[model samples]
Target: MQKLATFIRGDLVYDGSLVSDATLQERFQSSIDPEVVASPPLLGPKGIPQFRKLDFTRDPRLAGVQNPTLVLWGTEDKVNRPSGARSLQRRMPNCDVHLFSKTGHWVQWERADEFNAMVVAFLAEDSADALDFRRV
Candidate 1:
């Protein structure tokens, strides 16, 4: 548990310059699954093989997606770089990209309010557009 917490604190979460220890712990605890903590397959040899296989550069399906999409990324994320978001925007015809300045891999946890608001707004806009199209 300590090792996982340390990794989350040091690597997975924000850059440690802006977030408070208490807030980080609270967010971590809230998001942590006890079962996952007990048996972490994500760290095992079979863990995240799909991630290793992911080659966005060669993925032709990205350009085929037609639905409205939103790609939210954290600028401080060490696991997945911000360039991925831009790449998705360039490939997807109807995609919007939003980057959180000081957040990390856990953008939803790190910027809960802002993330929630953006998601809600995106959905609302999509819904409205669909309704307009139906009426037309």
Candidate 2:
């Protein structure tokens, strides 16, 4: 935990300068609990090994998705690039992308209020659209 925390604090914008060390530490600590550690992580060694091998980026099925989608991303997210969001929007015809400035991979945690509001609005809009389609 120490090494991973040190590395992230030094390399990322989500470092102590943008986000506090205490907050990062708390989140990091929570994930390292005995129960979580013992469990086979989805993306890790113990879980489904095939998950790591498959590249969703090139998956043709993405274009087949017809549902209205809201894709949220952080402008500063190092793990998932913002361009990925744009690609999703392009591939998924009914997709909308929203980028959060000065946020990292943890956009939900970093921009909780704005994230929640946007999600609620998206859901409401989708629901209204469904109702309209039904009426037609």
- What lDDT is reached at residue 67 by model 2? 94
lDDT of 1 at 44: 21
The stretch of ten residues in a row with the least summed lDDT in candidate 2 is 7-16
lDDT of 2: 0.77
* Position 21, candidate 1: lDDT: 67
**Candidate 1 per-residue lDDT over residues 7-123, each given as its tens digit:** 777777786555566765775675577976776654423446665556463477889999999988999888778788888889999999999998889898789899999999999
Please write out the lDDT profile of model 2 over residues 57-132, one tens digit for every residue.
5467889999999998889877767788887887886888999988777778778899999999999999999999
Error of 2 at 69 (Å): 0.4
Instruction: Please report the TM-score between candidate 1 and the true structure.
Output: 0.74
The regions of model 1 sitting more than 4 angstroms off are 15-52, 56-58
> How close to the true structure is residue 121 of candidate 1, measured as C-alpha lDDT?
98
Query: What clash pairs does model 1 have?
Result: none
Clashes of each: 0, 0
